[model samples]
Target: MLFRLSVIIVVMIALVLSSTWSVNVQAQGGDEPEECVEFIQQVLTDLGTNCAGGDPFQGCASHPVITLDIDEEETDAYTDDYLGLWPIAEDALEPEERAELDPRDRFPLLPAAQVDASRFDLANEEWGIAKLKVSLPHYPVAADQVEDTVFLAVGARIEDTTTPSDAYFPAAPIDISTTAETALREAPRANADVLDTAPSGVALAVDGISPDGEWARVLFTTNRLGIWDLAWVPTSVLDPTVDTSDLPEVEQDSRVPWQEIFLHDGYEESDECSLAPPSLLLLIGPDEDTAVEFWTNELYVKVRGATLFMIPPSGNVLMAYVAAGVLLVDPDTTDEWVIPAGFWGYWCLSEPDFYGGRVPPEPDEERERVIVPCADGAEFVRRLPDDDMQAWLAALLNPLGEEVPDIVETSGIGGPTIDLSFNNSDAIDPVRDACELGQLPPDICDLYEFPS
Candidate 1:
């Protein structure tokens, strides 16, 4: 009973001393208060280490191996101090243009040797290295800024303070994204100008991360001079294992005969057709049931059970079917057809064996043209210019053609997948003019929403 009373009295004495010491050093104007000094002495003594007299000036001083914050106030102060030290790029500077920029930005600048403040919590150990809660800046100023807070370690080495039992390592090749629409800003701060928005799954390359691991310096593509660039994003939205390290910073411009500017891959200008939107396309399915669907907003046109079509940019439709008659119908109502994968394979009129059809039993001596087997035996020829009519019909009605599937396995569906390289610009204009004049079938004209 006497020993227990003595223990309580000692604790009371220490509390009184601690309170007095805290008051004395409250206005000392140093980053660490005398209160922290007392806490450090207690921590070192508890660990069975003697700092001589427990005097910071006389004995060993705190070396700041890491940081720990006591409450909400210190966390905010730490976050502010860290941001002032954050890096920024010069105006109009491209991340790719800089020779100093490293391709991969690993999170937690230091991979290891960091510990959280909560590890130091005990009965009376309120002071230690401050582990601060921080939030990195995001683009477009997000509406809810509270969810971004993350715990980060800050510290100093002590004479004999206990080493953290738990150590954390930063994410290797850091990657991040926002849950909703978030902008990639020019600088790593909320007030910085917004460069552009990145949708979910638009993978970004990590270049660097803030000290607190809250903000990430990310690489992005832009429409400016150098094209590839860097921006800041909040670490909160980072997706796990989503690394884009191999993607090139500056996308190589694709060469086309028309546009000098670099276009994305899988696109090239045609020497035959006049300048038109790349959206103009043709699709051929791998099977006969697969349908051919055109796109220009509304289902512009659809052909079911048809292997081939002669499409001109003028919104006119001419098609040929194999083993069945062509069914031109409204885009939405068309069934028994899947979108064509590409134009070059299977349904290509130029390929001799792509379709099977009957040959004309007799030749047209007057036109000097012979009927050739095409479109699985059903031959329908549209009158084109006198010069192009024979060659065009011959290409369509490939008499020596072999059986081909409706759709090819390896075809792209968007836009015109077929690589039509015809040099006959004159023939295209006339057919387009005819279609514009409503000379085609009613259902075919209806695709363009032309007045019936």
Candidate 2:
């Protein structure tokens, strides 16, 4: 709690220090915020911009990391405390020209990766330490096989707070609709279970599409079950007018790992942050039906083309499967409980300590940190509120270069989890009685009406 407060204090202080923090936009001749003014007035301190030691494509040198395909070889991009990332020009600019640069050019969202609230008084944002975000035409990986589908990364958009436990494929919105009555299925194939039948005009929101573009992952709230589900529906139902150009094509049988394994190596000495929470890596599979399995925090997990939020053992390890995704949380290695996306599942690694046992109260301040096993202190599963999910997604998709907040926690929302916690995985599935694999019975499924 204190850790979160401290970060808030840092930003509040920055906003307080900034003269034009409240200004709608910075107008020429108008007084800008101190942070913005200092960005240009003082030597650029952003780690991403400097040549000595900073993020990719240093302001004064050729590309140190991946060679960008951008028009400008060397571009100047810095972060300000108040305003997010400020991209000026490639070459040196005259003071007048610098002043002429529109303040709106700067991004508004900041990353949670390199959060430092203690020194909000510091000069620039991305203080030479923020993780680099870059676009790689062909990202080189350690392994040999690589394709455009790999999204093959060079740097950390999918990285996490602790070592090793990080990464996932990018996720785009699914606010598309159906032109005619659609059949939601259990899998991408025609023989799959018919989960539900939607009306002709029914609009649907889904995430990824099948590799062959024949299927889409759709979420539906069944009336019989009175629960939301993660199921597959044919792409043919999509409204012709809905623009799905932005949708990322799902890679069937993905070669990419949905998430990296946890090293079990605890936080470092320099990583102590009173209580600033570690960021959770929430992901939907890049593939279609095949489930991706991996090891982390002494637990084995299974997930198909579903949305799962994982905080590896390195940092208060939390594995939560949300809304319309299925995540298998198996600690004992037993036949895992199939945690239905009907209700979100939270598997705990640590009980009292939220941030992987870090930032416990002041009395335990001197205690040594260790990787808390998921079975030890974890409660297995808990329900997460809707607001928490929204805040997290916003940070992940922040247009300001994916501003991942170090702590994407919701405060003042009563609490993180409600009083209800699932006893077993079977208990978590709301439709098991009336529906099997989202296959609805005519007697129960057809009775209720869904929103358009």
Candidate 3:
């Protein structure tokens, strides 16, 4: 057809013009002839493929990882105004001189990382376009190398990550009773504006305790502001493990949200117990934030409120070898120990539910009160003595092939579930009628038993 003939004529004209331009540029001998040839070849290739399809240069430049050394001596050329690519001299030169030429002189050095180019020059074809900008990684900048104009390609893939070693211990829970009435204030001082009154037995998140052990920064949700806020409260109301004198000062403006506290829905403002669930009650252990000054390495159970410090025995040279393997701390420096997630190498205990069962029975409100029925498969918190705990720690650190003693069982808090039933029948006297009627038959008394 006539349309097919017209397309052939247009292609021939483009090739003729490219040939003419290439010969004139080669005669001048300014830049590399191959660069011009390659550019033309690429244009023809794109026209054959992309143009034949639809978009000419769709998604071509977005994937190559390119790096370049900045021409520091030519810093004057790279002002804020000249963000676009500039030309470099390509006259007859030695290898050293060629190295000195700026990379932008040969080809444009696009920065895809630091800047958002999705809707800018990359998307528009009015400007001389090669390929998609976002298809490639960010251009590298070597600020420490040559001070003169130097062209160097050194691309590196940088990934942002937070490892267990680099994780920070942001805040700890305040061990205060629900009955203790304390005011959370806007400032660290007593006369500051009162934000909210925290009732006792509700474990609140504490950022830092004051040096004198008189005040501490605690987080609370204020009804007045209708937002989560950090405020100061008296230290006397909190049950802490370490001396307040050792705690670092918390900057009033630099407070971050405690993730665990923000996600916790176990306790409300009116709850009697400090914890959210009865299952979590058994996880109550030592307060880790308070022990930072004395212990170098510690294992913290965030939800269970337990922290077990790794304190290896001294005086023996072999102890160091053992300590090195287990302890993630360095006593020489002031670095605090941080417990990673899912490290269940410590003793734990859970408080019994409201009705007396497998665990040490709950207190009787009155002698006249009737005993509640026990659930099908009741479980109690596995406890170990102080000596047993020390022995377990010693066995872990001991280089010698000592027989490991099974002292404490690991907690089943976050582990596999178990049904607390005896032959599929309720084991306790007060089987809540609601659970008894359920299809799965709730194991009200069963608990998770972690491996020791």
Candidate 4:
């Protein structure tokens, strides 16, 4: 009995081993083992590879993780030096006056030497604080001692994630300037009101600046009436500049003039409605015949005396409509017929349902032509020719009307006749009005009009 039990146990063990081998074989063949290992490695790495020897499972052999220790003394000294040069005040100043102030006095300069491993926690796992570095030129206090000092500020938020068990790796450096500015603009601190208010109109045309200058200021005139703030930084700071040598150059027109206009349709205090005010109106032709007018409520453009177009700040769709019709020319392109009129209205007739038919059969010359019902019995049917026959028939017999032509029985000759009788209230006045105005029918227009 004991020998029999041993044999049974051995058989059971063999079966279990066979099952395990089959499972491993299936896994290896169905899914790549190397890819699975790689995915697992990535998941482990993301879950804080704080273990030793570059392996999270091991301790003491890995490279040491860096942590930040903000230098309060250095920061304070930098702030004082910067503020001493450009003192901020509660009163708002003009752009020209602000430009006259030294940039060194207004903005703190970042020290290249101070950038160290400890200054920036390279191994920080939190996305918010992982790559946090101090941005200089932060204005914490309003300097009452200086006049016309402009302050441009940026800030950073610190994050903390140094634990080995954490499930996130260090993030790349991110700029919170826009976010900081938004918050400051919306609700500024009591002492930081100067940063919130935009400078008044005072143009300062920036000639080129010295290579060593800390800041560059520029000014341009606007017809808009309101407080405006202009920040000047090198174009490289905003976006990467494209190399022009590879691109073909176009001829420049010295006499080509452009004008800026501030068009206002309505006034409201909400964030959506905040807009700058009017600028100087200008005329381009004889006796103000081709002139642009800017007022508080309306913006008017008169081309000679025959055509006058008024554009409200809101609901400006003339450009969009023209673009849809291909009537507006693209200033960049030399090709005149790039856009064709009525191109927007053209619809492809290949869609089966669009013509009220089943999927069309493969192209064959011997197949009998199919006749479909039109939505407007005679009028719609009459319009169908060439490729549009299917569409017109679909429209006519849309609801399986009783008068559907007998096309199904007659092959191509006749379909069930669709009812063409119109109710007394369905007179064609609305259609006439639409045709006269060069627009869709009144019922269709009402269906597609912009929501009020």
By TM-score, the best candidate is 2
Q: What TM-score, computed on C-alpha atoms, does each candidate reach?
A: 0.17, 0.32, 0.22, 0.13
Residue-wise C-alpha lDDT for candidate 3, range 392-425, written one tens digit per residue: 2343223322211122334467853323211212
**Higher-TM-score candidate of 2 and 4:** 2
lDDT string for model 2 (1-452, tens) is: 21222122222222212222221212133323545434322212222232232222112211112111211211222213212222434332321121221211221111111111111222323111122222111111212221211111111123222211111233434556677877787778889778688887776766567768888876565442232345677888887676666555653332122223332223221132222223332233322233344444444565432333444434444445332234555512343444444233444454325443443333232223222211222333222223433342333233222211122234336654212222223322333433454443343322222111
Clashes of each: 40, 5, 22, 27
> Superposing every Cα of model 4 onto the true structure, what RMSD results?
30.3
Badly placed stretches (over 4 Å) of model 4 are: 1-64, 67-110, 116-130, 133-216, 219-452
lDDT of 3: 0.26
TM-score of 1: 0.17
- Which scores higher on lDDT, 1 or 3? 1
The 10 consecutive residues of candidate 1 with the worst lDDT sum are: 255-264
Task: Please rank every candidate by TM-score, starting with the best.
Answer: 2, 3, 1, 4
Q: Rank the candidates by lDDT, best first.
A: 2, 1, 3, 4
**lDDT per model vs. reference:** 0.28, 0.34, 0.26, 0.20
As for candidate 2, its clashing pairs are 47-128, 112-404, 112-405, 112-406, 316-356
Model 3 TM-score is: 0.22
Across residues 303-357, which tens digit of lDDT does each residue of candidate 4 receive? 1101111121222211110010111122112421111111111111223222212
Q: Where is the poorest 10-residue window by lDDT in model 2?
A: 147-156
Off by over 4 Å in 2: 1-180, 219-230, 237-246, 251-265, 268-452
Give candidate 1's error at residue 99 in angstroms: 34
Estimate the TM-score for candidate 4: 0.13
**RMSD per model, one decimal:** 34.5, 16.4, 29.4, 30.3
